[model samples]
Target: MNQNVRNHRFRKGIAGLGALATAAAGLFVGTAGATADTTEPVDPQLAVYVEVNSNDLANVADYTLAESGEAAIDMAMIFAANINYDGEKAYLHFNERVTETLENAQTQIRPVQAKGTKVLLSVLGNHQGAGFANFSSFEEADAFAAQLEDAVDTYGLDGIDFDDEWTEYGANGTPQPNAQSFGWLATALRDRLGPDKIISLYAIGPTYTTTDFSLFDAAGVLDYAWNPYYPTYDAPTVPGLDDRGRLGAAAIDLSNTSAATAADFAERTVADGYGVYVAYNLTATDQSAYLSGITEALKGESTVYRAAPGDTTPPTVTIKSGAKYTKGDAEDGYKRISFGLHDEGQIDRLYVNGVLKDLTDDRWSDLNFVKSGAFGAVKGENTLQVLDVAGNTTEVSFVLTK
Candidate 1:
């Protein structure tokens, strides 16, 4: 199916009437019931990669503690593929250290996994520099896979990701290799790991468009592939052309190149029936902006939804402020009830007593509700509710004494 058509259909399927209501109201809607109205339908095709180093992993436990049961994030991928053979003992190699770094990372990661976060351990498989080299041959590749398999088995890893960029030297400093080699390695790894485990690859940039993908059994072996989509200044030019001539060559300069291009690539890959993982550099917020674009693209679709790294279920609502009111104060009669709501996905509407109010725009952070309405206590109970972008609702109640 065409990407535009597929996206349209998916949007229709998930959004339905709830999104229309949000668009019409221009405010967040809340519900007493569990199911609330959402602005955009959930996009199952959407996934995010949280690249963590030893330093980042060390603080992961503390970082997650502040979430307070409201945030829903999924699938955190740790860098360097470090795993311990045993609790204290770690397997360290020259290419990448699996020693103390891995021990510390695993120590932090265990709690996250126990709390139901999907952990993806990424490793450099026969890469060019500072790692195992020359897995071009099948025998060499098999040995590398065996090592990886052992590491995975020992650590109880959820999945393994391959970052293989090995190839013969090319004229333009690009790797030139027969694509079949990669396919063979992927197939072998899948067979060894069995069906339940996820086998993903970090795909190359230029190779994504021109490489022969037939060798790899896309349906059987590969679960997903992530493309960095890093931007390059070099424009498309003829081979053997002078650098000066290439500079003058007319190129397609997209207005919002990052998001627009990334979305285009994601849509194309998804159409090929492959799940797309948008990779972002943690230090660079520009990558985050690119992810925002991808999010917008998915928002137009229905079946594709995004979940936060730690959360599986949707967000719940709580009364962060204005839980109590003092008697005889001027503001006492006019109760300004405030709420704290967090949704990993986008939140569209918030309703109080069936009347929609604008808390804030779509964001992943907590939203504060401060509506000026006649909400005072008459020696009875009061209710507040919050709605998310996926039609999920959470509520809190309080009693007032006069």
Candidate 2:
């Protein structure tokens, strides 16, 4: 899943949508092409990269969410959803409102760059509708290459992430129409971006069957691949493209109990030699707790932060200010309750009832994190708990009134 895809709620035709996204939502067709491959590999970068939604920059606008705008991270993929390919050119099409939102994201991302991360725009071709894979011939690939270069230069971006999935085929046994073109496109992008820029793809080792890995894995074509929520059965495969061929581990369930799960995956991949370790979409108040496991395996650091010492104080928890649930206050019987969970040390877990919930949209350093989202409250009681990494805890209970 391209986890950070925009909410494509624009009710316009592809033509109009294409026009709006680049020239304001009207579809424009483009040209394509093809290529062969190479096997030599480059060194893999052992660094941490994250995907933050450009559609909702506010969710990650805060410094706490900012992480290190620089060296603390390796790269941050600013996700731009639905960059449609028209057999002639590739275009990013979003409604006007979304366009403004992304512009804000572009500005907001500067802080992340300040801390040392290379922020790149990741354009994904939508799976359900017309996409890169939907183009009729190989020549359209060239069309996309030109347009993509324009976007990179226009936005002053560091690089691009090609996120394409296989949903274009009409039948089970049929061959993909743009497969060869896309391979050429990948090579074209590598050449256009030059040697230093970062280029990655969205695919796992074993699960992605439709894509011909060999085509895109040429020595200089790809830099990384995001194969999230890795399952044990698939095992690890050597990657294409030289330098830092890391596998991404999604943190949808990276928690206390699952730390070992992530650690094991990181260890084995590193042991295999060419692979690097990485984590995705993590928002814990204590981001270290989640990333520490992966880092331990990658660098063999003797001290795991989960076991490290500092502040031993219990965390403080409270319902965020301005929350309301009076008559007609909430939407569809679900009230949005925001929480402020903080600790002198690392805040580990924030749970509503017994199920743990992430209390912050952004990752907190060693003190605070904000968590907000809709809550399903019946006509009665609710409970919340916030725990520090050191095992100290805090709790809050309240009643909803209509």
Candidate 3:
């Protein structure tokens, strides 16, 4: 079937999930006392999509072997896809023929699903682009979607993401039917898969002056349309604009926004009648902050909280003594300390003596501290405190000499 015609017919048969109504209701409750000129604030939901290249998994596993296999899975939930496609084929292709990659991803992704995290399968829309591009017609797109649907069914993928950035390379300097074609494609997919699945698009935030929201409006077919906020690509560096303006600008320029951008996007998505998710390339030092922003945006407060005073839950810490240590003797000369913490709200700050350590550093996974400190151990008992995200102090304790 011709892709466009099929998409049109499919869209005609399905209806959106009524996300706008939910958005409207949320807006009414959130903006009860607003003035006529004051537009309802946008409250976007925040999520991160990790672009996992199958080619890169071995490297990732190698780098994270010192930690745990689950680390890769944890990283998977932060972003949308394990494979990046550039519209080249109807299905995922790997440089290595080993099927273990798929099996490992499925195993790793399950924990994320258990945590109720949303997963998206990303595909590039441009035929001439990188990753998986160069399809000649809409039938190819349909065939690809079918293969993708099978993968989704097998691995429990949450949805599909369409990213088409090749309009700039076309003649006449216009994207011509690209957005329309994508809209139709999304509609058809919605019809075939039903409303429970999410269909998202990645568009140039600023450059694309016209958008056919009708496709999204039809069956609420499009769940999320992600406009990247990379500093170099979409967002502007200027200040003083409302959060939405900042985000919109960021979408256009691909610039990085402040931590507040999370809150801003959450607000905007809620206001604009769309589900929202943010995209950030991960780094070791910024993980905590990124998670902090996401937690606040999603749940309206930081999940990391300080235990109130008088709270009696003793903070527990588990230490892993490396293999280099002698049995029955304290491993005193170790270069790092590895531990897991379950803070039931009484710990304040984790400290090595009196010095503070950053838990967001890349070396953190290696050091094994939950939050703060790079590398250093004081002789005798080491004090560990449970604290809230607000910095309120709660309980303190000492770890015995190893």
Q: lDDT winner among the candidates? A: 2
lDDT tens digits by residue: candidate 2, 1-402: 243242321112342333235323221111000111223342223333233432233223222211212132356555554555344344665444344544664565665555455666666655434444544454656666677676666656677776553234433232354445556666777777788877666542111333445766555676665432323212222235323334332222332326777667666555444344444443424456555566555554422222223446777755444434222223332233455666666676666656665544322422122223224333445566777765777776654443
Name the regions of candidate 1 deviating beyond 4 angstroms: 1-42, 45-54, 58-73, 81-98, 125-137, 166-176, 205-212, 231-277, 283-402
lDDT digits (tens) for residues 1-402 of candidate 1: 112211211222333353345436542221111122223333323333433431353232322212243112234555555211222222323223333434654575676566555556665422222222222466645655676676667666667765433222242232344545555556677777888876655543223323345655555666655433233211221112112211111111122245566566545433323323343323222233444444344333211112245434556665454445222222353234444567766566765555565555465434342334443223445555566665677765554433
Residue 47 lDDT in model 3? 41
Please, what is the TM-score per model? 0.43, 0.51, 0.45
Model 3's number of clashes is: 59
Candidate 3 per-residue C-alpha lDDT over 202-280 given as tens digits, one digit per residue, 9 for 90 to 100: 5432112233444344325655444432421122111111133113212211024555664465444444333344544
lDDT of 3 at 330: 33
Question: In candidate 3, what residue range of length 10 has the lowest lDDT sum?
Answer: 60-69
Candidate 2 residue runs with Cα over 4 Å from true position: 1-70, 85-90, 94-102, 105-107, 166-175, 204-217, 229-257, 299-402
Residue 197 displacement in candidate 1 (angstroms): 1.4
By the lDDT metric, which is better: model 1 or model 2?
Answer: 2
Best by TM-score: 2
